[model samples]
Target: MPRSIRYFVAPAAMALSMCATAVVAQSFSSSTFEIPKPERQTFVPAGTSCGSIVLTQSTSQSITAANSVSCNAGGLHSDNSYFRSFPLAADINVCEVQFGIETATGASGTQPVTVNLYSGTGAFPGTFPGSYTQIGTASLNVPDQAATIFPATVSGLATAGSNLVVEVFTPDGQTAGNSFFIGSNASGESAPSYLQAADCGVTSPATTGSIGFPGMNIVMNVVGNPGGPSLSVGSAQATLVDQCASNPGQANGVIEPGETVTVQVPISAAGGSFTGVVATLGIPAPAGITYVNSTSNIGSLADGNSATATFTVTADAGATCVTGFSLPINVTSNEGATASGSVASQIGESG
Candidate 1:
């Protein structure tokens, strides 16, 4: 059996109180706590794409006239095709992609941009055959004469230990001398940028260049789950009983000295499945509270499943002076994931 581990931090302690029966006035309150979710990983090489030399001409015009003529042909410019290669630390489902681009003042236009993710083979500018998959594309509107980020949504799976290639295609060729450029970082750190121009074309052996200086401003958003199961606490309830004869008719939130409080917490599991769940209560001895039953077994939970645990607390006859108190509850899974939550209430003393 594969071993898994999960860690959860329960919410802050809830307030509960036990006082004389004479103190019948009290109020109940509820608040929610946030559970940590799996974090998204981002890849950003050291560089910016503003003010870098033009690499490939995305427009359809020939490479020589690409800079002079606006290849407004409305498709990938044979002159400018760009790609970046990087490695994945773990298996991830890619969710988003962003690119930095520059446009001349008053050169606003909308075009559909295509992005592809490929499994790499060989070297830096790996051989991207027809086997590559077209993840998704976005229709972006460029702002004239300004530096802006173009964001797109793409979905694909990249396995760990594989070199991933991200390719970007520009829409339509632009008019001659009309300036539009892809951003790049000057530092060729991390992934090397490759260019396939009309002159060199994608078919010719690709040449490595730092065109979009700092390197191309490309970002990849990856969705992945942290190891093990994830756990969280839901709504909680407790039974209140006044053991002290002095506080006979106290409300749910109020208890007299020698009263007993029973708390029930709801637990849930997400992200993965696990077995042997247990819940325990942690009360400070100095708080004048005793745990009648400190632990409960929850058994097993499949992913997206839920269960509840109950605990009993008794107030010491001599427990006094404190108007309110709190206790910590911890829930653990045999697989190693743990979650915590608390219950609390206010107390008033009666004559």
Candidate 2:
């Protein structure tokens, strides 16, 4: 994955620089918004050419703006614009936008493109509240054989369930023969349909409305603290394999005197709240089973994260046979929360 983080603090503020960097690193996350191909067809202006706009599943998860319409003049003001809305599940600091451009055939020239973020008023392709900011810009050259990813750093705060309109603008002043399309994917689908302006100029005017395309995939990377950390542990299992046996295949939930068994468990964190988690296996000494360094340290975890821990147990050579022995597992976090579970281990003579 191509991961990138952007700090919103200004460079002149030296005192808060380190703190900002740390918070930004911890808050890094991403989301991809996508939509399926539309049942109807739509058209959009690309410089001097008009292209049929439709969502295609064949080209990965991206929407295709096929530039087929051509114009006689090359220098005319032929502006093209495409817009998509992204809904946030929780409050987040918008950081980056990643996209790609594909040009099959067209004049060889540089196409000036700009990406902007706007707060939607309401409904699909809702009204822009005039509170919009330009996040980034790029100059795309013609004859791009492969899909090229363009990543831009954007700084803004959005409320939960809020719609953030992402607009891509291809202005005039470039070669009219320069015809191409923007690439998108259907990895993550969400609300608020994709919109575009066919013959509209550099900016997406208020009059521009929603198109036939409902879902278009445009990936957005954001950073935020969802909530306090949560933790969980998967089921624990024990493995016993005779070292001297020819096959030495592993046995489940069974062990013998003087033999060793390994227990494995998986731990996870939800809401990214807890840090410095540790797992320990608690076995009574009187049971004749020794805990040989059976502790796993899981440094830290963010929300929706996970880790694994393993424990080793050894049975005494002269120990009495035990059936269905219960071994306790204790997982503690620095945040003052502890989770407990148990696994069964059996020690008996095998024919």
Candidate 3:
């Protein structure tokens, strides 16, 4: 089955340089921002032609720009800006790039300039993706813009596993040169299906506002009984959640004909305060399965206990924080055995 992919934010500029690779190396002479804006010339001029969006595992491939410029220690400028689309293979999740300045012409002065990189689901943006949209940026000063080298990486960006779009733009009104593929390279990542997370529910008195920091309570009563089978992971981890901070996100426990256990996941309000809390079930899942009550549907845990995944908001004193939230229940076997939906009270506030 085709799997869903997840992305992680890459490290800032310096961290990437420490571990540069020759295989996935750069091609442009310089990736610096240097072209001076003419009194009226647009950086990415009106009729400029953008490049193609292709899916490939190759880390580097030669590409041509619609228009080209000169070179400096920094590298090249884009009269012809380019965009490339690549599919992140199922076995990997991260992509990296180093910029070079080349094909230069005119001007030789250093200025603090910015470059923007954007990631989205489709073709390149006709206009630039918002300044707020770039996943990463770099700044440099050089004899000429193409003389400076800009290095950047894209990490933890989720992909449906195919046709993910990546584009580079000049932020200082200068245009970006065509980035050539250096090699078919990527950081190996575990398959998304194997990732899992575990957490116990929180049981607490509401104080006022948001409680339940990332880690506060013990995740009790794992859905499968004790001594159940263990989970496996490739590169990523299996993430679980304690949905109900003070209340359960799913039914409390299951009482069945064959195996029955009382599993409890408890939650507590932070030091006598009440605030809205967000307890996630897990990062979104791949296609083969989904999590319910923090357990795989194949079977119930030893104790028959379940967990919760939720997002709740709390108001200030007397602001009417959420009174309760609902739990979603599912039964893999008999349809009639399922429990009706349930709601529990919000931890009461003290202050």
Which candidate leads the pack in TM-score? 1
Candidate models: Cα lDDT each: 0.45, 0.45, 0.24
- List TM-score per model, in order: 0.37, 0.35, 0.24
Q: Per-residue lDDT of 79-132 in model 2, one digit per residue for the tens? A: 555556656565543333444453323454344456666654365343553544
lDDT of 3: 0.24
- For model 3, the stretches where C-alpha displacement exceeds 4 angstroms are 1-81, 91-95, 104-108, 111-115, 123-134, 142-150, 153-156, 171-351
lDDT of each residue in 1-351, candidate 1, tens digit only: 563322211112211222564212111111111112211122232111111111221211111101111112221232355566656565544433455443323234443456665654345454465444443333333444223334443334455676656666653343432334454333233445565444222342243433222223332222223323456543223335443456556544454567776667656665567788898887563277788989989889876555777777777777774457766777788899776656565444554
Give the TM-score (vs. native) of candidate 1: 0.37
Whole-structure CA lDDT of model 2: 0.45
The true-structure Cα RMSD of candidate 3 reads 25.4
The Cα error of candidate 2 at residue 327, in Å, is 48
Worst 10 residues of 1 by lDDT: 61-70
